[model samples]
Target: MRVVMFGYQTWGHRTLQALLDSEHEVVLVVTHPRSDHAYEKIWSDSVADLAEKHGVPVLLRNRPGGVELLGALRDAEPDIIVANNWRTWLPSEIFDLPPHGTLNIHDSLLPTYAGFSPLIWALINGEPEVGVTAHRMDAELDMGDVLLQRSVAVGPHDTATDLFHRTVDLIGPLVTESLDLIASGRAVWTPQDRSRSSFFHKRALEDSRIDWTWPAEDLERFVRAQSDPYPNAFTHHRGERIRILSAAVSEGRYGGTPGRIFIREGEGIVIVTGAGARSGRLPGLVIKRVRTEDGTEHAATDYFRTMGGYLTPRP
Candidate 1:
């Protein structure tokens, strides 16, 4: 079948690969145009690059729903339109032109995690399960008829960056299967239950701050959620901001006030937390690694020893 593709970021890159690997004929690609020098870094791989490699026509548009975009798709006359990680709203004119309408691949289960940063928000809220869903595109953001979904377990050690890589890995095969089913006319479209829908906000640099008022386990989850590549849970010590690289929730007691340094053992430093965030348990975290404002990473205990000032502060 002749296909028109629209996608952006890593997810879109995977979708294009899936379509190229499958039996469908991708006639053209619609992607965001290059921006000013300052904004360019935020944009990932260009769809035009992939199109050129595959000998497919590429359309660079800041918005995908405009009249010019509609005219382009109409002229190409693709049988199916597949959207993935695209930033713009897909207008009805383009959707109606394709005999199969349009199918979109969302990075979460329908009616849940329905916005950008779905996985990051899931990690922040301490959710154990996250997944990818392919759905029939509609006007609403991620509100559409579901075509397929696959769940991934979020381990205690899992972070937003980890889940993102795993999700990207699944897109190649998952999208191919969903497209095949739709092409064969066996696509099962299930409407999402809007009653159960929830959305999340984007993760800002400030969102990485660790709130000591939250319990130990809650702090632990927060630490793991943003760890490594994305960002790290952070706290203030001796008036300096320190990023918590890794931490383990302890079962024992730490009676000190939240943010107080309870003990220093080997490479670890036990930091106190509140009772509520712990889900009714002990209140603190054992941080293995931390960062100083000087940009140097240190074993939590070492930083405590080297710095003369108070390592722990009262909340």
Candidate 2:
């Protein structure tokens, strides 16, 4: 099959690589230019570079569709269009251009976690498993018909960075297998259950702020979700910003206002949490490690030398 790939970052890089290694012909590639956004910078393997290395035609577009882009797609005459981690919505003319339409590979198990930073969001929400889904592109965001899905278990101690490495590896194989099925006319597209669908916005610096009103277990998961290589979950203490590098739920419940830097527990410092914390039945967040505004990491014990303050949402 003659293929046109639309992708950006490591996800797209892997998709294109798989297509290159397969019997299919990758005629054209479209990808986004480099971004300075916090999340966009990570897992950024260049789709354009890989396409160029293979001598395949490459087009860089922030959003798909322009007269030139359409003309190029027509000229390339792809049998199918395969996209992964494309930053923007693709117009029908672009996704529906080829005979087989578009095969979109997403990082999460669709009908849930359907938008940006899916792995991070899933971790924060404590989803038991995280995986990749290969589906046919439709008008809505990740609301496509399912082709194939492959998942990996999300361990209790797993971080978003860890989940990323696990799921990104699934792209190449999923793309390859999905394409083979489509090419051979064995593909059975399954319509997604829109009732079970969810859409999330792109992550920003503000989204990583710690909200003490959440349960300690949830806060712990939030810390793991925003683990290193992505932005760390953060809070403000003594008018200074501090990033949580490691945390856990406390062994005992504490009674205090949410965000209060209370007692020390085991190896971490316990911060009172949850809206119901005053009832003294809620476990506090045990902050094990943190990074100060100066980027110096410290044990939470050392960082909060004398606890008795609040970790605010802002300065």
Candidate 3:
């Protein structure tokens, strides 16, 4: 099959590599320009560079659907369009151009998480598993008919980075398998259940700010979700920003106001947490490690020498 690939970053890079390795020919590649956003910088393997190295035609665009881009796609005459981590919403003319239409590879099990930073969100919400979905693109964003879907179990202590590594491995095999099915006319596209669907917005630095009102378990998962290479979950202590590097739920339940620097338990410093903290039944968040603004990491016990202060949402 003659393929046109729309992708960006490592996800796109992986998808393009899969296409290149497969029997199909990648005629044209469309990818986003480099981004300065913190999250975008991580896992950023260059899709454009890989395409150029292989002598495939490449177009750099912040968004798709320009007249020149449209002309390029038409000239390339792709039998199918395969997209992964394409940042912008593709118009129908672009996605529906080829005979087989567009196949999008997303990082989550669709009809649930159908938007940006899915792994992080899923980990934070304590989903049982996280995976990738290969589906046919239609009018709605990520609300496409499924071609192939694969998932990995989210372990109790798994971080977002762990989930990323596991699920990314699925991209190559999933892309190739889905394409083979489509080319041979054995593809079974399943319609997404809109009733079970959910969409999320792009993550920003502010989204990592710690909200102590959440229960300790939720906060612990939140920290793991925003693990290193992404962004650390953070809080403000004594007018200084501190990122939570490692944390756990305290074994004992002792609470006052949320975010209060309470007592030490084992190797961590317990911070009173949850809206119902005053009842002293909810477990506090035991902060094990923290990073200062200057990039210095420290044990939470050493950082909080004297307790009884509050960790605020802002300094």
User: What digit string (tens of lDDT, one per residue) describes model 3 on residues 1-315?
Assistant: 999999999999999999999999999999999999998999999999999999998999998857999999999999999999998899999999999999999999998999899999999999999999999998899999998899999999999999999999999999999999999999998999989999999999889999999999999999999988888999999899999999999999985999999999999999999999999999999999999999999999899999898999999
Residues 130-201 of candidate 2: C-alpha lDDT, one tens digit per residue: 999999998998998999999999999999989999999999899999999999999999999989898999
In order, candidate lDDTs are: 0.77, 0.94, 0.95
Screening candidate 3 with a backbone cut-off below 3 angstroms (N, C-alpha, C), the clashing residue pairs are none
Give per-model TM-scores.
Answer: 0.88, 0.99, 0.99
Error of 2 at 235 (Å): 0.4
Residue 242, candidate 2: C-alpha displacement in angstroms: 0.5
Q: For model 3, what is the alpha-carbon lDDT of residue 183?
A: 97
lDDT-best of 1 and 3:
3
Model 2 ranges off by over 4 Å: none
Which ranges of candidate 3 are over 4 A from the true structure? none
Steric clash pairs (candidate 2): none
Q: How does model 3 fare in lDDT?
A: 0.95
